[model samples]
Target chain A: MGIFYFVAFLSVFFALMTIFTKNPVHSVLYLVITFFTFTVHYILLNAQFLAVVNFIVYMGAIMVLFLFVLMLLNLNKDTEPMKSTLVKVMGAIAGMCLLATFLGAFRVLEGQNEYVTGNTDVGLVKNLGKVLFDEFLLPFELSSILLLTAMIGAILLAKKETKQG
Target chain B: MEGAFILEKLILVVVVFTVTLVIAMYSTLAERKIAGFMQDRYGPDRAGIFGILQPLCDGGKFFFKEEIIPAGAHKTLFILGPVIAIITACISSAVIPWGQDLVINGRTVSLQVADVNIGVLYVFGVIALGVYGIMLGGWASNNKFSLMGAIRAASQSISYEIGMGLSLIALLMVTETLQLGEIVAQQSGFVNWNIWVQPLGFLIFITCAFAECNRVPFDLPECETELVGGYHTEYSSMKLGLYMFSEYINMFVSSALMATLYFGGYNFPFMYDLGLSQNWITIIGVLVFFLKIFGFIFFFMWIRWTLPRFRYDQLMNLGWKILIPLAIANIVLTGVITLIKDTYFQ
Candidate 1:
C-alpha cells in the first residue's frame, strides 16, 4: 500500500513535470516516467496483463515512435524554458500547504476497515472472459471500430504528400 | 487465505518489485552470455567465476558513475525517462502465476503474487501504455536519432498489437478463461498444449512476441546499424541500462506468456500422475514454469543471431495482411471443428 502511494505520487509528480517543461523533449521524458509509474500502479492493482501491455504498447512501441518523431523534427532544448526559481518557490509553498491540510484530514485512515485478500479464482482468465463477452461486449466491439478508424487515420496521415510545385 | 488488510497485498507488491529488480540484474548477465556466444567468443569470463558476478560489477560501475545533465536537454524528462523505462519493466510481472498453490504445514500457499482476473486483458492494456516511456525518453533527449527511434518503436508496436490481440482471441475462445493459472491448468498435459490445437494462433503469438519484445527482424527501432541504439541513443548510465534491461525482462514475461497460453505452463508430462504431495507439486510446477521461460529466452537469443530484420513495410504486412486474417480463419476453423465434434461424435 505504501509502495502504491509512492507510485501514485511519482505518477503525479512526473505528470506535472511533463506538462510544465518548456522543452518538448523534457516533456516527453517525464511522460515516459509517468507511464512507467502508471505501470507500477497497474501492478499494484493486480492488473498483471495491464502492466505488461503498458510496456509493450505504450513504452516499447508508442514511446519509441514518439522519440523518433521528436528526433526527426529535431525539436531540441527550449530556447527559454518555462518556470523560474520564484515560481518554483511559490509552488513549493502551495504544495506544502496542501500536504499539511491533507495530513490534517488523514485521521480517517485509522477508522477505515480492512479488505480481506481473497482467493485467486476471481481474477483468473476464465471469469475475465465471461465478463468481457457478457458485460463488456458492446464496448469491446465499439473499441474495435475505433481502432480500425485510428489505423486508417494513421495510414492516411503517414502517406507521402506529393510536391505539387 | 489471510486477513483482509492492505498489509498482505502491500508485502506482496514489495516482493514482486524486489523479485523483478533481481531478475533484471540476472537478465543482463544472460544477454551478455548469449551475445558473447553468438560472436563465437568467451563472454564476461573475467568477473566473479564465469562472470556470475558481472552484473554486480556493472551495477557498481553505474552507481559510481557521474550523472551529467546535457547542457541543452529538458532536464526534467531527462531524469524521468530512465525511471519510467525501468519501473515499467519491473512492474509488468505482477499477474504471472509462478506455480500452483504451495502447500506447507497442512496449509496451501499460492505461488503467484497476485491473481487478478482479466489478467490477459490487463497485460494488454498495460503493455499498450508502456510505449509512452520510450516516447518520453526519446522526446526528452532532444536528439534526432533518439526521437526517430522512439517514433519507430511506437508505430511498430501499435501496428502489430492488433494481430497479437487477434491471435490471442482464438485462445480465449477455446479456453474461455482470462486467468493465467486457469490457462495453465487447461494445458495441464503435453497433449493438452494449446500449441497443437491452436497452432496458427501460437504461430501468430510467437511472431508478435518477437515484435512485442522488439527483437531482431522486428528490432527496427533500436537497430544500431540504422538508428544507432534507437531511442536510448542519448541515454547513458543507469537510464540507458534500464531501457536495455527492460527489453530482456519483457522477453521473460513473454516467455512466461507463451508457456502459459500455449505450452502448458508448469505442466510437465505426467505432472499429475507423479503422485507427489500438493506442496511438492507446487514446487515442481514453479520449476517447470521457469524451465519453459528459460527455453524461450534461449530461443530469443538464438534467433537474434540467426535472422536478419524485416523492413518496416514487410513487418507491417506480416502482421496485418498475414497474421490477422490467418488468426480469424483459425478461429473459424476451430469453431467448425468443435461444432462438428460436439454434434456428430457425441
Candidate 2:
C-alpha cells in the first residue's frame, strides 16, 4: 500500500510539474516523464500491455511530435498562457466542484455491480483481438471510415492552390 | 520479495546495463574504425594499444569540457534536454528479455525485469518517448539549424514509425503474443526464426529500424552538410556528447531488438546439444546474445559509412507512398497465409 501510494504521489507530482513548467519544451519533456511514471503505475497494476502502449504512443510518438511543434514555433518566451493566481484559484474551485459532483454521483448510484470480471483472460492480446474484430465489428469498421475521413481531410487542408486560382 | 531476490535482480540489472553501455560505447569506436578503414586511414591508435581506451578518453573529454548553455536559450530546458535523452535511451531496455530464466538455490528467477504481456508494445512505447529527447534538445538550443533539424527528426521518426508498427503486425499475427519472451520461445529451435517466415516483414523491419535509428539512407534529419550538425547544432561539450552517445545507445537497443525479434534470441546453434551446467549455460547464452548484438552493431556501422542518405522528398515518399502501403499489404498477406495454413495445411 505504501509503495503504491509513493508511486501515485510521484506520478501526480510529475504530472503537475509537467503542466506547471514555464518553458513549453520543458513542459513537454516533463510530460514525457509523467507518461513514464504512469507506465510505472501500469506496471504496479499488472497492465503491462497498457504501460507499453502508453510508452509507445503517448511518450514516444505524441510527445515528441508536440516537442517538435514547440520547437518549430520557437515558443521560448515567458508569455504563453500562464494564468494569474486568481484565475488559478478559481479554476481550482471549479475543478474541485467537478470532482465532488462526479464522486457524489458515482456514490449515489445503486446499480454499480453491472459488470464483474472474475475472468483472467479479460486483457489478453488474443482476447482483445477476438473482441475487437468479432464483437465490435461495426465500431471497428466505423473507425476505419473515421480514419479515412481524417486522411482525406488532411490531404484537402494541405493541398496547395493552383496558379489558375 | 526477499533481500536475496532484490539483490539478485539488482545484480542482473547492473550486469545487463553495464554490458549494454559497454557495447554502445565500443560501437562508437567500431563506427569510427569502420569509417577510417573505409576511407583507407587509421581510426585511433592512441590511448591504450590500438586505441582501446578511446571510449574512456572520450568520456573523460565530455566530462572535462565546459558545459555551455548558450545565451538566449531556455536555461532549464537546455539542461533538461540531454538528461531526458540519456535516461530515456537507457531505461528503454528494462522490458527486454535478455535470456531465459535461471533457477538457483530453489529460487526461480526470470531473465526480464518485467514480463508484461505487452512486452513488445512496451519496447515500442519507450522508443516513441525517446524522440522527445532529440526534439527537446533541438528546440531548446534556440538555433534555426537546431529547429530545422528537430523538425526533420520529428517528421522522419513519426513517418517511419508507421512502417515500423505495420511491419510488426505480421509478426504479431504469427506469434499471437506480444511478450518478447513468448515471441522468442515460439521461435526456439532452428528454422523458426521470423526472418524466414515473414521475409517481407523482416525487410520492412530492417528498413524501418534504419530509419528509426536515423542511420544513413534515412538520416535526412541530421545529414551533416545539409543541417549542420542537425538537432545538436548549438549544443557543445557534454550536452552534445549526450545527443551523440544516446544515438549509439539507441542503435544498441535497436540492434538488440532486431536480434531478439527476427533472430532466435540467445538460442544459438548447439547450446543444448552440449548439455552444459546451469551457470555455464547462462554464460553461454549471454555470450551468444552479445555476439549477435555485435554482429548487428557491425552491420549498422558498416552501412552508416557505406550508404548515402536519402533525399528529404524521397525519404518521405518512401515512408508514406511506399512503406506504409507495403506494410499494409504485408499484413494482409501474412493474415491470409496464416488463415490458409491453419485451415488447410494444418
Candidate 3:
C-alpha cells in the first residue's frame, strides 16, 4: 500500500511534468515515465497481463512513435512560439472546468464504495478471454474492425500523399 | 524459513546476473574471433591465451577512456540512454527458465527468478522497451545522422516485433500456455518439441529474431558504411560500451528465449533411460540449456559474418510483406490442424 502511494505520486508528478516540460522530446519521455507508473499500478492491482500490455503498447510502441515524430520535427524551445496571456488564461479556465466536472462526477459515486465481488478472476488471461469471447464478443470483433479500417485509411492517405509528391 | 527462501532467491539472482554479464562479455570476443577466422586471420590473440583476457582489456579501456557529451546534446538524456539500455537488457533474463529445478537441503528451487503466468508476454514487453534505449541515445545526441539511425532502429524493431509476436501465436496455440516453464515441461522429450509441429513458425521466428537482435542482413540501423556507428555515433567511453554491451546481452537473452520456446529448453533425450537421480538430471538439464543457448549464439555469429546486410527497403518489405503474412498463415494452419485432430482423430 505504501509502495502504491509512492508510485501513484510519481505518476501524477510525471504526468504534470509531461505537460510542463520545455522540450517536446523531454515531454514525450516524461509521458513514457507516466505510462510506466500506470503499468506499476496495474501490477499492484494483480492485473499482470494488463500491466505488460500497457508497457508494450503505450510506453514501448506509441511513445516511440511520439518521440520519433518529435525528433523528426526537431522542435526546440527557441523555435516555440510564445502563447499570449489571454490564451494561457483561457486554457487554465478550461482546465478548471474539466476538473470541476470530474469532481462532481466522483461526488455522485462517493457513497457507492460497497465491496461486492464474485468470480474475482477478472484480470487473468484465461478469464478475460472467456469473458470477451463469450459475453463481449460482438464489441470485441467490432473494435477489431474499427482498428482495421483505421489502418487501411492511414495506408491510403500515406500512399496518396507519396504519389502526389 | 522466509529468510532462507529470500537468501536462495538472492543467490540465484546474483548467479544469473554474473552469468549474463560473462556471456555478453565473451560474445564480443567471440564475434571478433569468428569474424577474423572467416577472413583468414588471428583475432585478438595478444592479451592472454588466445585473447581470453581481451574483454577485461576492453572493459579497462572503456573505464579509462575520456567521456564526452557533445556541446549541443541533451546531457540528462544522453546519460539516461545507456542506463536504460543496460537495465532493460539485464531485466529480461528474469522470466527465462534456466533449468528444471534444483533440490538443496530437502527443498526444491525453481531455476527461473519469476515464474509469472504471463512469462512470454513479459519477455515481449521487455523486448519492446529495448527500442527506447537506442532511440533516446540517438535523439539526445542532437546529430542528424544519429537521429536517422535511431529512427531506423525504432521502425525496424517495431516492424520485426509484429512478425515475432505473430509467429509466437502459433507456438502458443500448440503449447496452450504462456508460462516458460510449462512450455518446457510440455516438450519433455526430443520428439515433443514445438519445432517439429510448427516448423514454418520457427523459421519466421528465427528470421524475426535476427531482425530483433539487429544482426547482419537486418543491421541497417547501425551499418558502419551508412550511419557511422548509428545511434551511438556521438557516444564515447563507458556510455558507448553500455550500448554495445546491451546489444550483446540482447543477443544472449534472445538466444536463450529461442532455445526455451522452440528448442525444448533444458530438456535432453533419453534422460529417463539414463536413470539419473533427480538432482543429476537437473544438473544435466542446466548444462544442456547452456549448450543450446551457446549453439544459438554461434548461429547468430555465423549468420552475421556470412550474410550481407539487407537494403533498408528490402528489410522492411521482408518484415512486413513476407514474415507477417507467413506467420499469420502458420497460425491459421495450426488452428485448422488442431481442430481436425480434436474432431476426427480423437
Candidate 4:
C-alpha cells in the first residue's frame, strides 16, 4: 500500500510536470515517465500483460513518435506565446470544478459495499485471452476492423497529399 | 527457508549480471579480432595474449578520458540517455532461461532471474524501450548530425520491429506459448526445435534482429562516412563507453534470445540416456546454451564485416517492403500447415 501511494504520487507529479515544463521535449519525457508509473500500477494489480503492453505501446512507440514530432518542430519556451491571466484563472476554476465533481461522485460510492476483488488469475494472459475470445469476441473483432479501416484511410490520405505536392 | 530462497535468487541475479558484462566485454575484442582476421591482418595482440585484456584497457581509457557536454546540450537528458540505454540492455536478460533448473538440497533453483509468464513480450518491451537512449542522446547533443542519426535509428527500429514481431507470431503459433522456459522445455529434442518447422520465420526473425540491433548492413544510423559517429558524436568518456557497451550487451541478449526461441535453448540430443544426475545434466545444458549464444554472436560479427552497409532508402525498403511482407507470408504458411496437420493427421 505504501509503494502504491508512492507510485501514485509519482504519476501525479510527473503528469503535472508534463504540463509545467517549458521545453516541449522535456514535457514529452515527463509524459513518458507518467505512463511508466501507470505501468507500475498495472503490474501491482497483477496485470503483467497489460503492464508490458502499456510499456511497449505507449511509452515505447507512441512516446517515441511524440518525441520525434517535438524534435522536428523545434518548439522552445522562447517561441511559446503567453496566455492571459484571465485565461489562467478561468482554467484553474474549471479544473477545481472537475475535481469537485469527481470527489462528489466518490463520496456517493463511500456508503456502498467495498469493491470486491478476487480471482487474480483473471489478469493472466491465458484467462484474459479466454474471456476476450469467448465473451467479447464480436466487439474485439469489430474494434480491430475499425482500427484497420482508420489506418488505411490515413495512409491513402497521406499518399494523395504527397503525390499532389 | 524463505531467506535462503531469496539469497539464492540474489546470487543468480549477480551471476547473470556479471556473465552478461563479461560476454559483452569479450564481444568487442572478438569483433575486432575477427574483423582483422577476415581482412588478413593481426588484431590487437598488444594488451594481452590474443588481446584478451583489450576490454580492460578500453575500460581504463574510457575512465581516464575527459568527459564533455556540449554547451547547448540538455544537461540532464544528456546523462540520462546512456543510463537508460545500459539499464534497458541489462534488464532484458531477466526473462531469458539460461538453463534447466539446478537441484541442490532438494531445492530446484531456476537459472533465470524472473520467469514472467509474458517472457517474449517482456523482451520486446525492453528492446522497444532501447530506442529512447539513442533518441535522447542524439536529440540532446544539439547537433544536426546527431539529430539526423537519432531520427534514422528511431525510424529504422520502429519499422523493423513490426517485421520482428510478425515473424515471432508464426513461432508463437507453432509453440502456443509466450513463456521462454516453456518454449525451451517444449523443444526437448533435436527434431522438436522450431527452426526446422519454421525455417522462413527464422530467416525473417534473424534479419529483423540484425536491423533492430542497428547492425550492418542495416546500420545506416551510425554510417561513419555520413553521420560523424552518429548519436554519440557529442558524447565523450564513459558516457560514450556506456552507449558502446550497451550495444554489445544488446547483441548478447538478442543472441541468447534467438538461441532460446528457435535453437532449443539448453537442450541436447539424448541427454537423458547418458545417465547423468539432474544437476549435471543442467550444467551441460547451460554450457550448450552458451555455445549456441556464442555461435550467434560470431555470426553477427561475421555478417557485420562481410556485408556492405545498406543505403538509407534501401534499408527502409527492405524493412517495410520485403521483410514485413515475408514475415506475414510466413505466418500464413504456418497457419495453413497447422490447419492441414490438425485436419488430416489428427
Top-TM-score structure, candidate number: 3
* Predicted complex 1: DockQ: 0.28
Residue B335 lDDT (model 2): 90
The second chain of candidate 3 has a TM-score of: 0.99
What DockQ does candidate 2 score? 0.65
| lDDT (tens digit, per residue) of candidate 3 on B145-211 | 8998999999999999999999999999999999998999998879998889989999999999899
Worst 10 residues of 3 chain B by lDDT: B212-221
Candidate 4: list runs displaced more than 4 Å. A81-118, A160-165
Taking the tens digit of each residue's C-alpha lDDT, what string does model 4 give over A36-116?
999999899898888998998998899998898888778887887799999999999999999999999888877573232
True-vs-predicted CA distance for residue A33, candidate 1, Å: 12
Question: Under CAPRI classification, how is model 4 graded?
Answer: medium
Per-residue lDDT tens digits for candidate 2, residues A34-122, read: 88888887666655556667777787777777876776676756656667999989999999999999999877774653222244454
Global lDDT of each model? Answer: 0.77, 0.81, 0.91, 0.92
True contacts kept of 4: 0.71
List ranges where model 2 is wrong by over 4 Å.
A1-45, A76-121, A161-165, B103-109, B275-281
The parts of candidate 3 lying over 4 Å away from their true place are: A81-119, A161-165
**Model 3: how far is A111 from its true place, Å?**
8.6
Give TM-scores for every candidate, taking all chains together and pairing residue i with residue i.
0.74, 0.87, 0.95, 0.94
- Using DockQ as the measure, what is the rank order of every candidate, best first? 3, 4, 2, 1
List, residue by residue over A49-86, the lDDT tens digit for candidate 1.
55666756676566655655665666645544567899
